[model samples]
Target: MNFLIASVSSEPSIDHAPFILSGVLLSLVVIYLASKIGGEISNRLGLPPVLGELLAGVIVGVSALKLLTFPESGSDGSDSVIMWLLQTTLGLPASEVSAVFTQVSDVVLLLSELGVIILLFEIGLESDLKQLLGVGAQAVVVAVIGVVLPFAAGTAGLIFLFGMAPIPAIFAGAALTATSIGITSRVLSELGKLTSKEGQIILGAAVTDDVLGIIVLAIVASLAKTGTVDLGNVIILIISAASFLVGALLLGQLVNKLYVSVATNLKTRGEIITPAFIFAFAMAYLGNAIHLEAILGSFTAGLILDESDERNELQKQVVPVADLLVPIFFVTVGAKTNIGVLNPLIPVNREGLIIAAFLIVVAIVGKVATGLGAFGQPGINRWAIGVGMIPRGEVGLVFAGIGSSSGVLSESLNAAIVIMVIITTFIAPPLLRVAFGISPDLESKELKTEVTKES
Candidate 1:
């Protein structure tokens, strides 16, 4: 016993300990494996892969099984997974472990942020600007109506009923405004109705809704950060956000032209991919520099690149990176969520659930109202169009993450958003099939085609 004690005490002290390289690597392994298994299970169960990834985080996270953890409150906490692993592995104390884990957490969070940027970029890449623009006046009507009603309903409900502060309420309202076209398109393709007129209008309007939603998010985020809402500030945020998108597109087009000239003499494995990444990162950096979300910059970069002559080649190159990083982002989001916050026994959680229920109703009604925007075309089942617009999917999650990160949303509120996303996503496919009077048989190729378009 004496010898053992002496040997243990002779090890490096906490303050002098070296970084635990193994801990960092092991964390990655755990996160990736957990995410992969969860995603696969979710897919098999007919749910969005993101939902599974999130659940994986919860399953492995501190609030439940404690498989994954960070300091409960901030970088200073000793209870996180990183701290525990480093403490045990390196024979360091909890406080000393934080120094190293802080770096690790920052890396993970940065990668997660990058994941969303890539997500937005992927959305932009799959889109056809000309097709989007040609969606007609009816799509515009539907898109505008769809965005407005939801924003108004969500904001009003939160303020009048929930009594949430105005800034946070605005964020909540903004979260309600997102529509995931990817899910809608896939369901339409499954029904073999992707090429139909109603499908076209829904697709067009959903895409338009995304643009409007992001703009709203930008405004809300700006207000949240500024801690006050003023007309001049609102106008400036709008102008800056709009200008960044417009300017990025214009500059990207010019750069792409120059890139074509330079590419003729270039030969490298990552020739196309490298430049694309630089453009995206540069834009993201610029957006954040200007007090806007980096997603806007990356999204505009995608729009610009999609118009390039070499777009197909670039798309192929970017997929591998996206596949690797996007899941990490989703998994991190899940890991951060504390499922315990949603317990109905908790008064805040109970209140949040009630608000969430109301938000869902508003979400449904506001989107359903868009079907009426297909006015003058009585042949279209307007209800089906509305159903198609219901799922918020990844976009809603992204918005919620932003709100939570910016401190505009409480944990209970975030849980409510998650519940809203789950309900909307789960209901969309079946409701769409019923509305279209189609069989439930889904085509693998159709799903694949939409996936291809998205990447």
Candidate 2:
């Protein structure tokens, strides 16, 4: 026992930890700067802040500045400027370059993963389960159509026209199935339509779409690993997803009571916030253990806790943590985005740009068609609802990131996916206002004008 204890507590990594820590700190600094600057600029321009962060990532990533880049083979890929910077800064020789890259990459990636989980948890806190359930059959239809049309159309189109393989094609298709409730809801609230029939329907459908998208993500991620998608595997995945979701919903209820009780009885510094995160992390781990995405677990935990008495307080606490960590996920995604594939100078770049254009068209059309799926609402703005669903936002980026990191997508497809995400997210807010016959720039300008006059 003593020998094992000593070995476990040994400090073999003590010497190397500083460089890795330094690399992480450096990346965080770049991520925060990129996120804040990009978000602020996007906001100033009447665009989604997430769009700015992504564009900022592109600026700092391998596409341009190369300061926030990742390469498969460290500095030797002649591709990883981030690795080169770290090596130079740490004064490491070629022998330690790979080691530094691997350790730093792992640490940064883990943090990014945690960021997404937290982001999902926050989304759940903001969601209203009763409202979602109340949206009823129209929401269910919209969600189903939104998910099905995009996945089927995108996957089939890529296979038939683009001549892509199955796994990567599936990954790309899965990317299309999500609706960013966070972005959509915010815009609706700004427009004073959040509680309207149209807004409620859109929100409910978006929530359902998020859940479906997560399942699709899990299935595709597995298919990406195995490089095949047989009917049996797919059926098994469906069963697993359904089972996990139902189980998590049920389990969350039981755990919430215990969590609330324990938190209430305690008077510690982290009385509420700490227990909340503990529950969130535990659920995330359980989800991963069951072959699902960890975000789904955290998301479900958020929904469960939304029913608690301390929902508002918990949300207030979670936001700061999300503000701290979520940018890492978004910036890293943007940094990994390699836009060089879309360059028109090279012969092959023409095809990439073409595919990207095709993807953009499909992404817009597939999502917009969901608006037509609304039934029996005599005067409801189906156009606005469809437009609302258009922006894939952070959720779409999650799919793109999965495809990029897993090596399941080709450079062209990954770049295409990123392009599609950027365009869809950028245009949705404006298009949604347009659907209601509001000028794309009117609301933003009117708000600023009013604020200035008031001041």
Candidate 3:
């Protein structure tokens, strides 16, 4: 009887494994399908692709029918099996099987980071060094105002609302200082203003703003962990960033020269393309080792390769990998977001929604102030420049993630940040169209010509 009972216990049963696998697979399918459908709908409605992707995430995540769920601990054997399947796919270890669905969440965050890097690289590739130089002064003024105002406003807001938590509030304010160039670039591109003087200034200013934002994030992160901010470390970070740019610029010149030399003798396209990705990845790794954001390294790499003869070929090769990795990031970000955590009945809970509103306002008003910095420039609408800088997209989420992981931001704060990101991104394209006077049936030829002249 004991032997028979042991045999019965050992018998495998078709349990929850299948359901878990199906749910994860369906989630990916849904995200992809949503991307396709959303892209079409967004373009037709004169909106950015990111807005569509976020809408899709909201639909699949919590706004529409809720298909995904974070399973409770001590689930049955079938639940364990399902969780195991998701963990396996996400390459998460068995130890974290209890939070199996979070694996999908991690992937999305990873992709979002990857997306911003590629987006920056593409912007670098498309930029004309001479044009950027010509607009350098204006860009500097705009970038400075853009960073300072937001930092001040956000910090003050956090202090007034959350009280005197120096570290958390500082970090939260730092998060708000970022201007996502991706959203701005998309709106400008769509409005046929990408090559305009104002567009060039906004683009260049954005690059500057991002570099400053990363430094602030690093300092804030360090302060949060160490309980004090080191002035020496902050100075070192600034020097390092300046050195990175100077080194990249010098290296880019050398690479351009070498490419010109080798272009005549090159046998295959792969020879040029392969080394580019190797360099890009290597720079990214180096950035991480130096305690800087990895995307900063990738962006720097693109800037170094900007004027190379092989730049186009390299961009082509790198773009495909970027495309695949990017969506995974977005989908994973969506999965990690637990909308159920928000409770309208609780006062602390209500604080999140209120904070979200405040952030959206800060994000909008901060960029708009950049237009004032462009005050003296002729034929350039300062309002349009500020409007272009409105969308936060992946970069804002990245800040939120860093804050949350570092314990600078609570779970409620992270959710509020996500909502702010989505709202700002959704509003940008339409506002940009209105600002730039772009018609629904605007042709690419006109935009292309404008872009060429700007370059």
Task: Give the CA lDDT, 0 to 100, for residue 161 in model 1.
Answer: 85
Tens digits of lDDT, candidate 1, 4-104: 89979886555432554555566677789888899899889877787778778767765565555554323353666656766677676655666766666
The deviation in Å at residue 393 for candidate 3 is 2.8
Candidate 3 Cα misplacement greater than 4 A, ranges:
1-34, 37-40, 61-129, 189-197, 214-228, 256-269, 340-345, 378-380, 405-407, 436-455
In Å, residue 141's CA in model 1 sits off its true spot by: 1.5
lDDT to native, each model = 0.79, 0.83, 0.66
Which pairs of residues have clashing backbones in candidate 3? Answer: 16-78, 108-329, 108-332, 108-333, 111-329
Off by over 4 Å in 2: 1-14, 73-90, 438-455
Q: How does residue 265 of candidate 2 score in lDDT?
A: 97
| Deviation in Å, model 1, residue 387 alpha carbon | 0.4
Residue 389's lDDT within candidate 2 is 89
lDDT tens digits, residue span 1-76, model 2: 9988998997554356777788778878888999999999999998878889889988987778866767631234
TM-score of candidate 3 to 2 decimals: 0.75
| Decreasing lDDT order of the candidates | 2, 1, 3
